[model samples]
Target: MKDIARVSLPGLHKSSGGFKSARQVLIIDGRGHLLGRLAAIVAKQVLLGRKVVVVRCEGINISGNFYRNKLKYLAFLRKRMNTNPSRGPYHFRAPSRIFWRTVRGMLPHKTKRGQAALERLKVFDGIPPPYDKRKRMVVPAALKIVRLKPTRKFAFLGRLAHEVGWKYQAVTATLEEKRKEKAKIHYNKKKIIVKLRKQAEKNVESKISKYTDVLKQYGILV
Candidate 1:
């Protein structure tokens, strides 16, 4: 008992085995990467306890006819618990969410430990800040554009997301530009209102002074 009590924490490093190793953080770029292969690799790494951050999620690829795949998504979207939208099979429209759902299907997410492992995964739509400067890893087995034959045709996640009502299209300034223009119009209206208010106040003050002078002569007001 005395010998065990005297043993320092460092002395028990090998015996304890709990804190022997730390999990590594990994960044994967999804640009032109196959969705199924990427999901498989990510599932394997998550099982190994590595924290994964997937970027360029909109650039991820699904090898199928674009229109057919989009129709499938529409079918998924049509499924909704009418009584309660909260308890839903919640099909996501965003590319990042779609990629994440693909990864979840690969994992044993029914268990508590599996849920924790899934929590370690982070998915981003584009080169978000902080990750933009970091080095990203590429899996050669999962490349889409390279794997495709000259005659083959497939859909990209970005296009699929747009078809499914994803408003963050970097190419077309449809939603964003409209919002900016509306804001400018609002600001201009506010400026006009302020200018008119000041002019009205000045006219009112001049009228009040003239009335005061007239009243003084009549001794109605002092």
Candidate 2:
């Protein structure tokens, strides 16, 4: 395995001693990046024994005609064992899975070291929480707009996956609803806290006023 310290790339902080610490994790933002290019970079990092986490995989782009990409995926879906289709090859419909598979292809996945390297890689469709709060790095070399020609057309990995029956929209909608619900709950809790704080302040003011009156009547306060 190559030392991660020697492999310098954009957005990756350099360290002298390589990835000696297990806590050294690289969070990559896959938004607006070419799928193959991004996967290749990530595969290299993983092979170097560095843990890599790729988020926003849905935004990854593939260089080609959108329709032709869908057709290729459709054809891939048709591949199966004649004897037992269930026991043979499987196709992934999710963009994250597609990216993961792409990275796997770049590695020596059949070997134990490759398998271990793959175990260190994590790919996500969207920026889920914890990761959402974390800072994500971008590979300048892997950016679609940076590498692709101005006249060339491309398809988003998510869109291509959806065209092939990924149900991305439905899943995203559900996740959106859950996020909205959580936001609403948090807002309501904050409102309740403010209301309770105001009520407590009002009660304290009333008690203070009563004590002042009693003190004035006793000629203790003027």
Candidate 3:
């Protein structure tokens, strides 16, 4: 367990399990490659009664089998519904561990202490400007390397550039321009190819049928 402030016990890795610290705030930004690792770390603290506030949750990863994962996510929400069909208004909300890992990990601790510690966690997608408006500190050297992921492919490349620590907005913008340009060309070519193939097949079929009639007239059954 790495040394972090506000906790009397070492983090999850060192000890057997739960820590009984009072309400401590843990903030994690959810926009980079390290989200899952960070979330797991924060969740452990949360389970120990530390107040956790996650920021930028929408950026979390959904690795592999997106459809199946989505169904699994929906199922979790279904479980959290307030009332069954017979009872009261149905409202479904579930915890997110990318797929199901968060709730599963937290709830399944062997001890009763573990169960009690799992209740204080909270996560969110984005922090409102007001949440940390007072402090505008420079990124730490470790986190200076950390960056936000892009919304689209070009944005991704922009992030890649930023990872190398370059700040090139114009190049990223140009990459998007090129992607769109190439997409247009590809669409046009595909449309033309389909049209040509259909016309060629029609011409061949007509010629073959006309030749078949000629053969029939000569008593060639084919």
lDDT of each: 0.76, 0.83, 0.45
Model 1 TM? 0.65
Q: Where does candidate 3 stray beyond 4 Å?
A: 3-24, 33-39, 74-101, 108-116, 134-222
lDDT of 1 by residue, 1-222 (tens): 222122112322323322233425667889888888888888766665657899888888888889888898898888999999789988787888899999899888999878977998999877665676566777766788677775777888989998888878674335345545766797899899999999998889876988888999999987
Candidate 2 has a TM-score of: 0.71
Q: Write the per-residue lDDT of candidate 2 for residues 101-202, one digit (tens) a residue.
A: 999999999999899999999998876787865667878788888999989999999888888878875676477577658767978998999999999988
lDDT (0-100) at residue 216 of candidate 2? 95
TM-score of each: 0.65, 0.71, 0.37
Model 2 misplacement above 4 A: 1-18, 173-222
Candidate 2 has which clashing residue pairs, if any? Answer: none
| lDDT (Cα) of model 2 | 0.83
Candidate with more favorable, higher lDDT: 1 or 2? 2
Q: Give the top-scoring candidate (lDDT).
A: 2
- lDDT for 206 in candidate 1 is 74
